[model samples]
Target: MRRKAYDDLLAWKNGKTKQALLVTGARQIGKTYLIREFGGGEYDHVAEFNLATDDVTRESFLAARSADDLALRISIAADGPLVPGHTLVFIDEVQECPNVVTYIKTLVDRGEYDYVLSGSLLGVELENVRSYPVGYMSELMMFPMDFEEFCWATGLADQAFAMARDCFERQTPVPDFLHERLSALFHRYLLTGGMPDVVAAFVRDNAVDNVRTLQADIRRFYNRDITQYAPRDRRLVIQEIYRMIPGQLNNPTRRFKVGDIADVQRFSQVQDEFLWLSRANVALPVYNVDEPKGPLRAAEERRLLKLFYSDVGLLTGTYEKRSTLGILDGLGTQSGETSSSHDRMNFGGVYENVVAQELVAHGFAPYYFTGKKVGELDFLIEDADGRIRALEIKSGSRFRSHAALDKALVAPGYGIDEAIVFAETNVERDGKVLYLPVYMVSLLHRTRQLV
Candidate 1:
């Protein structure tokens, strides 16, 4: 599978002054696979090390005194030669041996061989290591495949995405046939998500049961990590918060309520627990902004927030297990068929989750707006021109705006000139608001550039 991060790896390899690269993300998102693939294609020899499984490799890092010494030990362990400018040295699962992180500075200073380091729970494990090579390493964040990458992996042609982009740029409706086809594909994405293994299973076998099984296995792996890595006394609290994600999203307000899971009266009691989860990349939280204005982060409401599962496929699997609904059976609705009303209602949360996931993947901090006398806006974003835009997400075709959006559009202090509504409708404009299908959320970055 192709990943957008591959291009970043290439840039790092060919830079004028290169430094060791660190790739960080949640587990099962393909960080290791991408680095290995890039190393194999771009270098003469690739020396790979896995600290999680090989005790000899971990011991070698502890014994080495200099960059040259470390290179010699890594070559021996990898059964390969580390030639200057000819070999790509990859360190996998480095978090398992956090002591080695600081040594990256020495290797980069030597500037002999290219280096790439990847790990899961990197931030959590870094806290245990005393010192870090902060200035000596360039960092890149990896995410589950975005919509366009998912299309490429699933056999969609480049022209298809180009057509969608053109439509979005011109603010024109896609041809009816293309719109239906993309909608069906988007629905499938909701079930399979961007996890490489889960998506590969669906593409190869076209079996929903297989996909569901894999999602459950991934969830189990995450559960095990919580037990293994979290502090002993807080293990139960972390698990409780993880299990309560789906229910918290179902609330009408959509802000995570600590009282729902435990008897805590103040968020301060569980603030660290939430931060731990966020750092692990298991949960994506959208902080509330009291006033919609410049520097959105300035007015953030830390206590009032919404939490979304990192992967939508996992969210759907958990929802199915709790509801006992046959969500997998509804995968055939990608051909313009309407899902049952029950399924539609269930998809509301899934739709919002995908929007949040895409926004984060595209380098946007998600924020929401709510007024006392007015209503709530689903999402708020700043465009390239420094104008705040209100985004409302609706799962059904009967989309409507609330007074809050109208007020924000004209409010001098708010500075929102345009509002966007994402729903199951064709592209159209209503006064200052533009209505687009939910799948077009992936094209938002390009649309912003065009504006």
Candidate 2:
């Protein structure tokens, strides 16, 4: 039930940043719950509004003239007094009223109360701002429960996580007992995924059927969002692309081909739909990079990319039945044996998607690299220091023979010092490449770039 984002909120309040706070994430990603928790604990009063469900407030927002007018209109709908310096004015579902972003500056200048907003589709709907609210608002992007946060929800102690972190930093292996336990939890995470309600259900009752039901409901909710929010002309296409994500990742190259979705040849044809899914916070696109270098953005081959679900577990749910057996069935087998079997079982894409989600949660913009001379590299990211690090996600024990990774390290001008391979194996090293247990990805957080 705990979230790493909770700490981010606490820091924002304690620091008195003075900017209107906006928390953006996919629906059911706990944006409202966490903000409510903060408002209750930190303020004497919470003047909260939910724009999506409150019809009167939605109409009032449209009719309001200025920050003062909007504040008064919203305050009339709030539960309690809006006291200066003692209240948190929380606005939820701002996607319904994107103008809230424009008026937030005057609201902050009023100096009446601390402002906070939560919304999905901020990426898609908050276009009136010209840019996504710079200088006037502080934005935080949230995602599903990562492995470490999942550990806390599952009641794994601080001491155990500290042990795993220490071993990872020191380049040592975890003990047999704790290693197996964490590995099992990682598989369970793959099975349950990170959606808040689904994770809560599994933790509260050890029922897999209930887990699948909640996941199904979440997917249906997203489908409804497409119907309600997506452009009228493209709703069907968006839904079709969303459904194709699981099958696309299951392909050998893991590249999402625009041509496969329709008879189209160029990415321009469906680029908006792809961007909509990403901006709506439901899907993730890891574009291909032409070179492995610093400032990975400059090298992006935007047309070529791999698409993954925002939640790995949600991706698993699309498999129709007994998705749990696919991931856990082959654990602890030799790396090579698992690799071959994973192809048949459709687990490779799931593992890759899990790594993509973890890297993103830890503040890395993931990309893949490939060429005729070099082989296929799974993920490449810039670290806190802006150095390039190559990552390979191994679904099984055959982790030793990575042709692409080996070539990338030795290539001239790459300046790559070491590589990371997150496999179902204990921590070990072969020269410059450090192999880590998949569960330790929780510790790979790049916690820098604070202003």
Candidate 3:
């Protein structure tokens, strides 16, 4: 998997006062595999349990009176003995029993063993639980692989992934071959969608048809999960929202409107479903950042909000756009014809989302910025140091948006340090603004030197 989250687990393991850890992500996003692979290799003895199975084990643990006693019983229930320094205890699907979170806090306070907890429906489960173990658990979010990680993991570390870090860091030109390959790979990623199994299969076979089959299987899993978890009436609304994503993004505004769902639908019926998807971690709602302040909350943005799926693959899978990749990958036609079609596909939306994915991966949650009278920026990322950087992504060859950048830079009392433009050419500064190619977004911290 080659995940950065694995490194987070390592830090928690070595901490002087480590808490019980919770690993959260969507189903089939490799939360379980990450823990097993990283834990098995790093620890002496790994004791794991799946709360979805074995009712007796659940009852026994829940019946315990003390955290120390519960830890001992959980170890015994897992068919292993607790060895504090040697064993790393893992609880999978802990959301099936949210009270276990309390027990985990007790274990952290009293027991000597290190613990790793993981679950897909933790968001929904948290709603049912009394309180979260805030101070007692370190949370590690495991999203689907980003494009660079996917490339490295699938034995296809092309020029794009290799140059991205350097492009943004040094503000240097990317090799021509790398840019072309990245453009191609960017299209491929849109189809395969960053699920580990799908990517592994795509790289192994080099067959788009096989990738489509895998995506369909994953889509089936998601549909079934929604049917089981979401309310019966709202299930259809959720499906409608999922179906509307691609077309909605194709709009110029890119903000989801209820009318975009179809010819006949009310926002009242679908808003709750949108919240449900957010709660299930199926989608991310990027609120408009009006104030551009610390902890940019929903209040900062009055009316605008955009929604994105957690993984592009799931988006493609659920939307039944598996054929879009065929046009993207230069397949099923004469060479010249395929080239023109590929160029027309204009991989912009996927690239914009890819940039968003990497920013989230780097520990910053991005918000979209727009104003009724002013203008719009594609992304606004606030770093740990309280610096809010505005990012504008342009996948096209032409560099526009200078006017919008000017408006954003001098809007009211906001201090825009320097704007970042991700495009094809490295256009030098316009006063304090910086123009960088899309390939360099991952390395923006280094590009900060230009500011």
After superposition on all C-alphas, the RMSD of every candidate to the true structure, in Å, is: 3.9, 2.2, 5.1
**Can you tell me which runs of candidate 2 are displaced by over 4 Å?**
130-133, 329-344, 448-451
Tens-digit lDDT track for model 1 on 89-197?
A: 8899988767667777787787788878888888687777666776777888888888888889889988998998899999999999888878877877888889999
Q: What is the clash count for each candidate, in the order shown?
A: 1, 4, 2
The per-residue C-alpha lDDT of model 1 at residue 447 equals 28
Residue 323 Cα positional deviation in candidate 3, in Å, after optimal superposition? 5.9
Over 4 Å off in model 3, which ranges? Answer: 16-18, 53-69, 156-164, 180-183, 231-233, 259-271, 291-295, 317-343, 401-403, 410-412, 424-433, 444-451
lDDT of each: 0.79, 0.84, 0.68
Clashes of 3: 2
- Model 2, C-alpha of 352: deviation from truth (Å): 0.6
Clashing pairs in 2: 335-396, 335-397, 335-398, 336-398
The prediction achieving the highest lDDT against the true structure is 2
Report the lDDT tens digits of candidate 3 across residue range 207-316: 77777788778767767778888888778878778666666665555677876665546656566778887777767766687665456554356245677777776555
- What is the lDDT for 197 in model 3? 88
Q: Is candidate 1 or candidate 2 better by lDDT?
A: 2
Candidate 3 clashes between residue pairs 3 or more apart in a chain or in different chains? 168-440, 193-313
Candidates sorted by lDDT, best first: 2, 1, 3
C-alpha positional error of residue 141 in candidate 3 after TM-score superposition, expressed in Å: 1.0
Pairwise TM-score winner, candidates 1 and 3: 1
lDDT of 2 by residue, 1-451 (tens): 7898888888877775558888888999888998998888888999888898988888899787777899889788887887888999998998888778878888887778899888888887886563444676777899998988887889999899999999999989999999988988888899888988899998999767898888889989999999988999889889999999988987777899788876668899898999999999899999998888878999999899999999988988878665347566444232235333443464678888899999888888999998787788899988778888898888865777788899988888775655999888899999889999888877887873223
